[model samples]
Target: MAANIVFTRIDNRLVHGQVGVTWTKAVNANLLLVANDEAASDPLMQKLMSTTAESSGAGIRFFTLQHTIDIISKAADRQHIFIVVKTPQDCEKLIAGGVPIKTVNVGNMHFAQGKTEITKKVYVDADDKKALLDIAHKGVDIYIQDYPGEKKTTVDDALLSKVQ
Candidate 1:
C-alpha cells in the first residue's frame, strides 16, 4: 500500500494501468479518493473504477462530496492524502462544498469550446480559470503540471493568454 497520500494529482485516466502502478508509487497514496460527482451517483461506474483500481497494496476509495470530506478528515494522520476531481468546475464545487481545498494541481485537460487556448497541452474555459483563481485567492496554491516532471503553471499563467 502507498504509505500515506502526499499528493493528489488529477488524472482523468483515474485508476488505469499507469495510474495504479506508476502514479500510486510516486505519490505514496494510502487512500485514493476518486472525487467525481458523476461517478459517485452511478454504482456501475463506481464498481468498474473500484474494481479496476484495486491493488493488493493501495486502498481504493470512491467518494461523493460528503463522504470524501468525512474520510479525508478522518484519515488526516495519513502521511499523504489524495483527493481527485475530474473537472475544474468539479474542483470549484468541492471548494464550495467546504472541502478545505489545499490546492488545485491540474493534469491533461484537453481542448474544448470556450476554453482558453493553452499551449498544445491543455484547454480551460473562463469558468475553470476563474474557479482556479478563486481557489488561489482563498490562499490555496494552484499549481499545474502534466506529469511527474514538468514546468509548474500558476493560475496567473493560465489567466495570462486568453483572459487578458
Candidate 2:
C-alpha cells in the first residue's frame, strides 16, 4: 500500500521547530520523514532529529534518497508521512523513483553564492530552477510558502523569471 503522504516540503533546515511542530500539526502527520542522504547516515543528526520529533509527539525517520524511495513505496496506509528534503533536486529524485508526490511546498532555500533570491526566503540557482521546473512538468504543484500561515506563491513563469 502507498504511504499517506500528508505533506512534502523542501526546507534546507529539515526537521526544525517550525517543521516539527507547526507543519506537523497543520498536516496532522504522525511520521516526519527526513529524506536526506547526509542526515540519514549521521548518527548525531539522527539523534537530534529524533529528539525534536519526540518533543512534537511524532515519529521521525531519516532515510537516504534511495531508502526513502524504497520505504515510502511500500509504506502502510496508516503512516501519515510529512516528507522533508533539503533541495528540489532531492524532491525530484524521489518523484523519479516513484514516491507518488502530488504537491510540493518550497518552504526555505537560504541565500548562497551563485544563487539568486526568488523570494525573501527562497533563493535558487540554475540547477535548482531546473529541478523545480522538472518537478512542475511531472504535474506536481510546487509553491513557495515558508510557513503554513503565509501566502502561497506558485512556481509560475514570473517566479522562475526572477532567477533567470
- Candidate No. with top lDDT: 2
- What is the TM-score of each predicted model, taking all chains together? 0.78, 0.96
Per-candidate total of colliding backbone pairs:
5, 0
lDDT of each: 0.65, 0.92
Output the number of the TM-score-best candidate. Answer: 2
Q: Which stretches of candidate 2 lie over 4 Å from their true place?
A: none
Candidate 2 C-alpha lDDT tens digits along 1-164: 67799999999989888899999999999999999999999999889878888888999999999999887877888889999999999999999999989999999899999999998999999999999999988889999998888899999766798776
**What TM-score does prediction 1 earn?**
0.78
lDDT score for residue 25 of model 1: 67
- What TM-score does candidate 2 get on C-alpha atoms? 0.96
Residue lDDT tens for model 1, 1-164: 32243665555555566556566666776656788767778788777766655752566777776666555545656545566777766677776766666666777677766766664565777776776677777787777776656688776643544753
